[model samples]
Target chain A: MKHTLSVLVENKPGVLARVAGLFRRRGFNIHSLAVAPTENPNLSRMTIVVDLEGKPLEQVEKQLHKLVNVLKIQDFLPHEAVERELALIKVHSTKETRAEIIQICDIFRAKIVDVSQDSLAIEVTGTEDKIDAIVSLLKPYRIIDLARTGKVAVSRGRK
Target chain B: MKLTGAEAVVKSLELLGVTDIFGIPGGATLPLTDALSRTEKIKYYLMRHEQCAAHAADAYARATGKVGVCTATSGPGATNLVTGIANAYMDSIPIVAITGQVATSVIGTDAFQEADITGITLPIVKHSYLITDANEIPYLFAEAFHIASTGRPGPVVIDLPRDVQNQVINFKFPEKVNLPGYKPTIRGHTRQIKLALEELMKSEKPVMFIGGGVVLSNAHQEVKKLAENFRIPVAWTLMGKGAFPDNHELNMGMIGMHGTRTTNTAIMNCDLLFAVGVRFDDRATGNLKRFAPHAKIVHIDIDPAEIGKNVKVDVPIVGDAAIVLRELNTMIENNNLKKTNHLAWVEQVFEWKKKWPLKTPDSTDLTPQFLISKISKAANDKDLIITTGVGQHQMWSAQFIELNGPRRFITSGGLGTMGFGLPAAIGAQVGKPNALVIDIDGDGSFQMVLQDLGTIARYNLPVKVVIINNRYLGMVRQWQELFFGKRYYAVDLEKGSPDFVKLSEAYGIKASVVSSVSELDEKIDEMINHRGPYVLDARVKEEENVFPMVPAGASLDEIIGGD
Candidate 1:
């Protein structure tokens, strides 16, 4: 099972390396990791999505807790949280297929961020499934470049 | 202040409060070395090998629980540090490894003496960085120290390219690091704590399996208090050696293979095994199925995966040991689950202890046991810290020395690494300068990084190194004796060992040689009272073995002792 872990750590030097080092040393396969400043000025939040199941996730969580700079670790399951991902895809476009591409974007609720007659830059935001669906739809339009912000999530309950 | 990489590294030292460092200078690190030559605030001890440098830094960190520092150049220099870095990661010691990389442009091109150090070190260090820009050096170095010294402390590396070392830049040490992806939870969930307590209260024959994490958390008092409150006999892993005083009534001593007979017995028969701050390493738990087979394990660790990695945990508290322990203590106090007596189990453990006493050989020559005891007696309980390399010496140190305080006995517990002593002794000495620091090392283990003698002498650090010169890799020989039917292949150490007195003199220190048991105390005292680095090269019987050793693949009952 894939695990998405939200870690809040002190915005201090070398912490990223430490966390990454720990995962690598323990042989935890990380699918994607994104770190950004949190609401707290002194803290940073990292969302690490790892391809680990059962006990390894527990061990990683426990180990992360040991870092002094690390303030919190929240392991989010698929159903317990609201997950979101953002992706930008630049597609080869022409007068002939431009309308068709725009129609596909409308169907997926994706926004066209940029258009240069020959190319269309589309931005999509949703759960992983939604993003994957949009990417699949854009494949026929000949996508030129693709970039994703990995996965970021928060719990569903009022906090 | 505008500074180059060398100056940033030097200034970063002051910022990190590092008064001394152990390293060697090469073409890649020359710029930093030149800057160090002019600095008076921090001292540098030139080492012979990068491995020795890393080990010394690691040792220093372990001894004092501070971030030990080491520096090396690019390529093989950085790779040589891999072993020591891995050792620190395994042992959970705080250390910072700084290496010089080739200039940024040539990094991927494989310029002379270049290596992908950060990439290579990625898995070993708690964190690592490749400072492509000189401006980032100060902040990165500061962050490295902060990360290395805090949390579940471990090694961190910063690879400074030579170009960065020469580039003068607008320098500003960031007040704080802005990494967003690394948060660690310090506190445990209240519900989980309550559940853990419930399990503890309901269970019979509960055993507390402690690891080095307790010491790292500085929760020895709390651990001892909790153990006493629950009347739980504590069985430590190698990493957990000094967490509880070995002489304490509840201490069954180090458990697992090579652990005490009583401890293994307790582990086997226990109903509830409460493991705190311990990773279930294979050495600690042989044949996972057979390990604590009957125990309903409550594993409290900061790492979540460890909870069910090897040994399954019924109640897993995924948080800091200190935080969880404090919570557990509070609940125990509030609920009043203190047992009046575990007299029967205590008596049973005592009976086992008496039945299988750690016996010594009848050889007239001095033994590692007597030597360890002599060293332990020579130093005060609170002031002196002991560090050891792996092998027979490490096991003997655990078995013989009564560690009354936490973080006082530093050893490569999880890694079982050789060449851990001298540098660790330096680290311990650096942690507490006023205290007497000693490395109770074996000759074979000591030779792994004997170059640390240079580091010790150069810094003028007061560390007494007592080498148990047995002229053989005693542990390997013992294994050969036990499992390989005494067909010793390559365990001999008769070739490389030089005269201790001569080696010490080369390092500008005095060394003494003792052959008999009668001269043990006098030699120990002489080393203890020496003003600076000293060596006691005590040549014991060549084949002296660490007894009461549980043969591999066998139960604790199959202990091998007696000649």
Candidate 2:
């Protein structure tokens, strides 16, 4: 099972390396990860999606909490959290495929961020599933390049 | 008053009650060394290598229960400290390692003697700091000591850039550390403690599996109280050697790989395994699936990550070992808990112990066991601190030496570093000047860091180095003999080995060599009674291997020897 953990950490150099090093050392499989500054200037929040097949999710959480920079960790169930992923898909586009690509981007509510004579860069943001669906739709037109900001998550709550 | 970062570091160390530091001066750390020399509050012992500095600091911490301090320069010097830092991390010794980093501008530019030490030590340290500004020195130093000594206790690294060290700033030591993320849980949850106690009361074949945490927390008294009050047998890990008295009837020797037959048997037979401060490591667990199969485990550890790390637990309590044990002891006393007798279980364990005693062969050639036994007897009356290099000799020392109290046996239990003993003995000797510090080492392991003999001579530290001179790397050779068809590839230490007696003499230390069993007692006495550092190379039987062996990946029932 995949576990999405929202970790709050002190904004310090090597904190991310420490966390990443731990996961590597312990052999925990990381599926996706996104880190950014939080509301507090001195703190940063990291959204890590880990595949926990061999070890328990609780153990990973406990281990993350062991790092001195890690201030807080919350494991989010799929239903209890709102997760988002952003991706930029650059497709091989010519006169024949440009209109079709724009139509597909329109259907997914994505915007054409950049357009050249032979290619189009489309930016899309949604849950991982929606992004995957759009990517599959555009795959018929050869994907020249693709980039994804793995997943960022926030718990849906007032608790 | 304004002061340079180097001065701030020295002042901060003094403020933190650090009386001694172990390190050698180098280019990157020259400024810090100058400042250290200028300060009268701290004494610096120049080590031959950065690795020895770290090991000495680790042993100092283990011996004194204080945060041991070590320093080193950038790049290779910092890299050399990795093994010792990892050793301390594994054993949970409180130590602060200060490394001089290349200037901030040169850290990533591959400048002379540049290394990202903080990055290198990220996984092993409890916390680390790379100071870019001089002002951070006071705060970082305070935080380094706080993190190293607090909660579970592990090594912490502070990487001081040369430019940052030269920057001048007003020095005012932080009054308190404000790390909101690093609060250690001291007291066990009441409900969990109650549940654990209930499990103990219900168990008929209960055993307490203790480890390094008990020693780290100074909870030996609490562990003894809990075990004796409940009539529970205590089986200790190698790191937990001195946590309980070896002579006590209830103490069932060291457990796990290279552990006693009786301890393993008791662990297998026990109904309730109350494990405190043990990680249930692979060496200790053998085949995890068959380990303590019949027991319902209640594990108490300060680090929550360790609670269910290797083995699942029925009841998990996260708290400091000493505090939790103390709380449990108090609750038992206040509630007047009935002590259940396990006479049958105790008798069964005693029978196993009597039947499968760790035996020494009837031979005139000094075996490692016989040599260690002689040393143990000679040092029995003195307050002794025993350290060992990893291998067959380490196991023999652990088996033969009877540690009566905590803080007596210090070894690289976690990392099992080969060259840990000599420098660690120096550290222990330096920490406890009056105590007899002995390094029981193998011929191969001793040769790894033999240069530290200079440190011992210069300091005039009365650390006795006893090398069990088996011609081969005995432990690996034993494995080859058993499992690898006796193809002893590259395990021999007989070729190109230095004459240790001459090496010690050159270093201005007393030295001796004993090849016969008859000379063992007299030689050990002479070494122990020596006024300064001494080295005794006792040539032991080359082919003898450590027994009561559970071959790798084998269950406890598959133990090979007990005859």
Count the clashes in each prediction: 31, 0
Which candidate gets the maximum TM-score versus the true structure?
2
Estimated TM-score for each candidate: 0.80, 0.98
DockQ scores for all predicted structures: 0.20, 0.81
**DockQ: which candidate is best?**
2
lDDT of 1 by residue, B67-92 (tens): 78999888988899899899988888
- Deviation in angstroms for B352 in model 1? 2.7
Could you give candidate 2's per-residue lDDT for residues B309-358 as a string of tens digits? Answer: 78879999999998998989999999999865566887787788788888
Residue B224's lDDT within candidate 1 is 88
| lDDT of predicted model 2 | 0.90
